[model samples]
Target: MSEDLEFDCGGNRGDGRLIYTVTQISYEIKLILEDSYPTVWILGEISNFKLYNSGHIYFNIKDKNTQIRVVIFQSASINLTFSPKDGMKVLICGRVSSYPKRGDYQVIVNRMERCGSGELYEAYGELKERLKAEGFFDESAKKPIPDIVNKIGIVTSQDGAALCDILKVIDSLNANIETLIYPVRVQGKEAEKEIPQAIEYFNSNHKDLDVLLVGRGGGSVEDLWAFNMESVARAIFASEIPVVSCIGHEVDFTIADFVADMRAPTPSAAAEMVLRSRNDIKKRIEFLRESLNGAINFILYDRSVELDKLILSRALTKPYLIYEDKISYLDELDNRLLKSIGSLFKSKSENLGNVSHRLDIVSPLSVLRRGFSICFDSNNEVIEDSKDVNVGDDISIRFASGSLNAKVKSCE
Candidate 1:
């Protein structure tokens, strides 16, 4: 073979030209793009926007003539103050680079700004006011959180730190409570859609849930944009289950916080609020037990004192003395009764004797006893007149104790 027809082992043909693999050429192109424009600023309208679950944002920035593909990685995107959406005019600062695999040029955005105003903040404010006017944030409409929750439905990213924090707090405090997690994207383009649907599902299917906690850990405004969405807010407002919003850190607030039944500063705080600590409940029960014991002891002591008083009372201790006094009084009455009866009998005897003496003085037999005689004619009637006795008539004379029969000789 000729020297020009032979391939050089050092990556060159017999010609003066160098040969490159597809990867080598792609890498060369990427290096050129990166070196040519290390950083640049562009003003354009956003289109074809998307936020992936990996926390990366992809979109196209277009002017009238042309458009360029842009990407914001998770690290840089986490620092963005607002979410980028289609049709929004934005000014972006980025480094130019190419995807070696696809051999495509793109801008890796590090910072972005709205062309006119803070679009996301303005939208947030406007929607908040409108929903407030519509009574979405009224305290009267908000459901009351139960003092004790049994089952809690959580709507958030399943693998996020927020979920872990909530579960850790709950487990530390109360383990008996059941947590039914309804996982969803907490932040992203699809997050707003998935969150509301999770809430509706819990409300429709798991009515047994005492409360629902919807939230995620601390993040940038763009990362937490899903919670600030109108759809998420409306879903929270419309939920039948009492919703406790735990989004971002203490200082970080979202539309969901206002629309929810309760707002917790953090995911751990939400767990603390929904369920009481096991130690706390045990302490309360112990307090009640002590109170009850105190009351019972007081009552028993009072009853014992009353029983002691009864045992020492005159009616109980000197019971026989009372009966003895009564007996003495009865004996006095009996003696008085006997004395009265004797006096009555003696007076009656004297009166009866006097009456006997008076009757004897007026008796006809008394006259006979005093040496006088009662004469009777033949008819045996007492002779009181001389005419009662006839001459030659038989007569009888009655003395004190004897009667004599004689002939009547004279009258009177």
Candidate 2:
């Protein structure tokens, strides 16, 4: 598509102007309108409101003089904070485009806001900020989702599609999961109060549930307003069981989403996320079984190899040969011991003989045998001086092997 388009006409008029076909003109006008007003904001009061089952809203927005058809496709409509009614004032931002099927000019709205709902949005911001500052959305505060989920508690309207969708998904996965549904009003008066009550109900009564799913199917912002309430958010934050916020569609977000332990875009997705499929579980078991078998086989093979080595070893094969070798070693040790004892004894005997020879060289008896003698006086003491000799004194003289009694005159 170009800013300027050119086309061929079969023939020219008398004025020499080109004629474009209806389809071509419609396309040309669409291009011109889109190009001229790619983006615009309009203020008007809503009228002729129509919300189709497809989730698209077709309505007219007009002041007193004229009205223009506004088309809010499902993609953009789900984000609407308020449902458009016959007399509600609104502001919309959109692009001007031609609808070729109807050959009509319409505005394809991308954003819509209620005329006086700014304060509500402001309050929402304030609460979000407050809760965030208080650590309501902290990741550390979130509980872990159990790896295996056997039971779950749901907080939604019992008759809503969200429950059915969740159950359908669980069934498709063939998970043996049980559900405890706490029915409550998802929207309308007191819906916010009911939502938190339902959450608390499950928490207090059914503490054994593996996880809690608190949400509903896709809806307008007003419909999901219950989830955005502070009470609902706090309840989710305080839940002992892990909470999975499965509110609306992927593009939609609520305060519950931030405070929850986990978030799922839709109820069916929550089911798929929280519970493993039977086939997947079986595959996991099979993988573990194979791994265990491999480990056991490796261990057995290793032990078997060790056992074979032991069986082939000589220590086990030739018992008598080992005993014979031991006997031979003992004989050798005995001979070595005998030689050691004899050598020790001979060394000791030679040392004793040397000591005896040294003693004999200094012995008195040896001196006597060498012709040396000792004398004794009357008290059997040896006299070395000549002055005290008396004729009648008695003394004993020791010779080599005998002693003789003598007079003191022999003192000299």
Candidate 3:
């Protein structure tokens, strides 16, 4: 399809040339630029970087000669690990689009990143260091993966290829394991909260889970930034159940990987590890059953041989022999008992005599019988000093066995 251009050459009628209004020219140029370049990745230095109140980011990507305006809406920009700054060298990927009002072409940025020195990687390293200092990555704190996992929780996007890979492995193994799928955003800003929330939910409420498989498929550093979040690492560390991190490719590692109980190279690898040989469990059980049968037979044979010997022994075959030995043993025991009883009685008698002697020495009646008498006032209180008695006071004299009442006639 083709449209004719109405030529208005400088407002004078019809010189055979295509001269269009400013608006028409701008529209044609915009359509040509947009339709020609569907998408582009531009390398340039950031200048006049601005994040608007409307949550849209505006910036210009420029090299030596010219610059192009760039805009990344909130949805894409929110996933940025590091804040974009002016004078920062960056690589931006977007489509070329024109603003009709200004008639200016700009790149509608879909993604942005620092070019040479990746700010996202630096931020990842910093977060890793911080978590390491906090002992989130300490091997000592890591829980051990159960040798036999019966139930496991999966925290990942339900529809992700990684989940499909994991489920395939698990299903193939025929592992009789209960699986609880906790679907979450695997990438982007929402993933930061969603991933950690799933981990916390499993830890707080799902105590019965044998293990947790937390991860997603491989992606760029920014795309996998959620797994590197501090909250996610803390949640993994806080889990009472063991967590196996299967994040990204074999080469990629996240904070969650370090803090997790175990790290699987991939999601399928994680699934394989969680249930090591479930499909072969029947074979193992059969082998064990044979082993037990053999052991029991061996044990029974040995026991029968011993029983034969015991039955043939003198104790059973010649019953009176046992009774004869037992009779002798009883006599010996009787003599020993008699001697022990006599020795015990002698020792007890000696101990009692010693105790009685000590008691006699400490007895108050012993001192009184040694010819001392106690005097009491009229109130019958013991009078130990002469000052305790007065001339008009009645007194009582107490001997060892008896007491007599007396009236105090003189002071002396």
Best by TM-score: 2
List, residue by residue over 251-319, the lDDT tens digit for candidate 3.
566788889999998999999987885545667899999999999999999999999999999988999
Minimal lDDT window, size 10, model 2 = 1-10
lDDT of 2 by residue, 188-237 (tens): 76888998888888888999999998889987667887887898888888
Residue 349, candidate 3: Cα error in Å is 70
Task: Rank candidates, TM-score, best first.
Answer: 2, 1, 3
* Best of the two (1, 3) by TM-score: 1
lDDT of each: 0.87, 0.85, 0.85
Q: Any runs in candidate 3 off by more than 4 Å, and if so which?
A: 1-115, 277-285, 294-412
Lowest-scoring 10 consecutive residues by lDDT in candidate 1? 1-10
Better of 2 and 3 by TM-score: 2
Reference-based TM-score, model 3: 0.44
Score residue 269 of candidate 1 by CA lDDT. 92
lDDT of 1 at 3: 43
Kindly report which residue stretches of model 1 are placed more than 4 angstroms away from their true locations once superposed: 1-116, 277-283, 319-412
Residue runs of model 2 more than 4 Å from their true location after superposition: 1-145, 154-194, 197-208, 215-225, 234-242, 246-273, 276-288, 382-391, 410-412
- The numbered model that scores best in lDDT is 1
